[model samples]
Target: MITFESVTKRYPGGTVAVDALDLEVPDGRTMVLVGPSGCGKTTSLRMINRLIEPSEGRILLDGRDISQTEASELRRGIGYVIQQTGLFPHRTIVDNIATVPLLKGWPKAKARDRARELMDLVGLDPAMARRYPYQLSGGQQQRVGVARALAADPPVLLMDEPFSAVDPIVRATLQDELIRLQAELRKTVVLVTHDVEEAIKVGDQVAVFYPNGKIAQIDTPQRLLGDPADDYVENFLGFDRGIRRLAFFPADGLDLQAGIVLGDGTTVEQARRAAKQAGESWVLLTDAGRLPRGWAALSDLESRDGREMLAQMPLAPYGHTFRVGKDSLRAALDATVLSRTGLAVGVDDQGRVVGVTSYERLRAAIQAAEEAADGQGARPS
Candidate 1:
């Protein structure tokens, strides 16, 4: 755990970089400090490692004052990542990863072996172990940086716009990798970024810092999008926050409708009966396990007179099916919009048809969820 009690930073000319900030980052949680330029985000992170000493207040690391710890020792125990890859151009990837371990008096062979292990841990191949930083692509270099940071296996990890240096595709891949690593390693991570979307995607808890070293609000991404503390926070969350909030809600609670499903190899007569029972013009065609195939109009089957309804051509294709219990509302909504029948096919984990949900029903669920969230003190009065 890390605690900031009235921690403030002052420059040589008395310029304040960080104000009297009081915050706590729980152990094994990814705490993101996000804001625009001059918000003192980097200063706050730097102070935790004693790179930029605070002029006032106290910062406690695991109940011990970081101020009391020696500066060089304090930095060795914290993993730091920055925007640049920061790998030494002259050193091999393995040597770069082994920098800290070597500095701490680990044998060269042991450090190299540890470096190889870290490379695999961060999804890097040993083939690149002997390559220089310049020989690797930007994304690959960033991976080496991550591997180097984890070389010491510090309990706390500080990242400052680490993925910002890569392209969107690579950045997204790195974000996913970080989440995967955190799930396994569970490091006490404190990351700083200017991107709100990145913060929501990567952070367990988000702190919105404003200009002049002030924290606007601190909350989970769901709560931040569902309810903003004030106008500044609401604007920062953006207008599509309602839509973004849907990603956090599961589709399992939706009251899905059944009976519109038709079995594979069913006769025209059978489909007609099922369609009539469903009170719909068309019945959804499903495979033997009740997984969706396409939509077959009852009239088309009726016109066929004596053929198998399953053999009849479909009116329109089924785009996709949303997992009934696993997928989120956004997935259901996307599926419903993409489907020709204006309904999302809800399926089980095995891809068997469970039921279906219409766009109206999906929208109503969103409204209901918003209302429930509002009533639970997530909305500003």
Candidate 2:
């Protein structure tokens, strides 16, 4: 929805904040600008709303030149969020959030009602509407800032290091909130950050800027992590890019072993014999409906006499597990790491024992992805 066509920004002292740049932010998708300080990431963002006019080339918003649009009118339709939140200290949270709607000439009551709805939408307590910004926590204030920016339901949003001022945990929470909000609202968002990790986490497309306001590369997070454009891009991705690549690799492809299953009412001797025949130390105990109850070890069954029930023997507690359909390899890895056997037990959506994935399988999947990436890199572009 926003396009920068050979845009450049220069100061009176001959300092070029932004070099001749051509970039596009597709409709309803987030594009992140990431680099170190003085790279003009923030300058590029402000130019979209005409907060900083470009010196050399024109910027287009929805096919029309922003230079022709009035500044106030243009800003009203474009949401702007900064690091400090910039809320009025004297105004209540609701009043602050309603600022944009009020500026757009909505009735006072209607604007405040809209503000309350936004507050709830951003996961804030509606009762806190009457409270001042100072009365709320730092995270709460950031939420209010987000509510304020989104109050008028603008088609485009500009966020300049909005999460940088907060602590790490709160920043993570805000990042997750932004992702959730983007999935629902799909606003054309351009977020500026020096943190490459944050950009990867939140951006649909990331623009890696160089020292002179030049773009190193602009691509999806998966592509950026899997294949950087140059050494500069690779250096920015850090040494852990391989681990980050796991975020994109699906868990469905991993080989899962068929689990040993036993009937709920089966005798201990019967269950033990079945487990031995299957070359498994433990057997998954299931009810008539095929729902997994727990795991029973063969040793537990051997100690139990016929007088004692199979359920009486100690059952190995099930650790972290995931549904077979989920795309998360991280959860599966977590399960393997926490389990004594270094294997993740995969259960169906109905809670039935489907199979188990060992650490070896997980390692092989990662190796395959890395090899695929290397092969792609070897080819000419």
Candidate 3:
């Protein structure tokens, strides 16, 4: 556990960057510090590794005061990742990752072996091991940086705006990668970011900072969105707080219409009957494996007289699907909007369609989730 007891960072001119701030980062959980420019989020992160020493008070790792340890030795024992990667230009990817282990007097071959293991762990190609930093893309470089940080298997990891340098698509991929890594590694993490959405997506606990080096609120992402502590934190979350809150609610319990689901080999009459039973204008047709094929209109099925298969007719696109029980309500909502038939396809992990949910059902689920959250909030802490 990392505990900051009345930690303050005051400059020579008496400009306090962090004013008597007290925060606790539980072991093996992620804590994200977020705010606008000059909010001292980065200042607080740097102070953890003694990069920027506090003016007063104590910063303790576990039970020991960090000030008693030599700054270089303390940093070597902790993992640090920055936005620009900071890889040595001339070194190979494997060599870059092996820096810390080699510095700590591990054998050259053992350090390189550990580096190779970490490369695969972070989803880098084994072929890229011999490549230089300049040869890889921005996203790949960031992965290498992550691999290097975890090279020594440090207990705590500090990251500052780690994914900010990439494009939106790459940034999202990196964010997901970080979440997956955290789940597997369970390192004590302190991340500093200016993006609130990123903070919500990755943090187990989020600390929203004021401009005066003070925390406005620190809470879980769900609670932070459902109930903002003040106007500053509320405004920081923006107008999409309600939508963002849906991320916490699972989509598994939604009432899906399975009656309108038909096999590709189904007869025209069967499709019409299924659609009528489900009170839907269209029927979803699936292949023999239960994978979504497309949507077949009931009117089109009715035009055919015989026992013709629904597969004979032209079908509309099914848009996208969300993993039921695995994805959040927000993902289901996105699928609903993108669908051509105004229904979200819920699928299993194998991408086989299980059922379909309508917008009305999703709306009801959201209301129920909000009501439950409100009920919980009314009770004493």
Could you tell me every candidate's TM-score relative to the true structure? 0.92, 0.86, 0.91
Best by lDDT: 3
lDDT string for model 3 (283-381, tens) is 889999999989988788888974888888899989889999799999999999898789978999999988999999998988888887787754223
User: Model-by-model lDDT, in order?
Assistant: 0.88, 0.87, 0.92
Query: Stretches of candidate 1 above 4 Å error?
Result: 272-276, 279-282, 298-308, 367-381
Evaluated against the true structure, the overall lDDT of model 3 is 0.92
Among the numbered candidates, top TM-score falls to 1
lDDT measured at residue 290 in model 3 versus the true structure, 0 to 100? 96
Error of 2 at 169 (Å): 2.5
Arrange candidates by lDDT, descending. Answer: 3, 1, 2
Off by over 4 Å in 2: 261-317, 348-352, 363-381
- Clashing residue pairs in candidate 3 (N, C-alpha, C atoms within 3 angstroms): none
* Per-prediction CA RMSD (Å): 2.4, 3.4, 2.4
lDDT of 1: 0.88
Please give the RMSD of candidate 3 to the true structure: 2.4
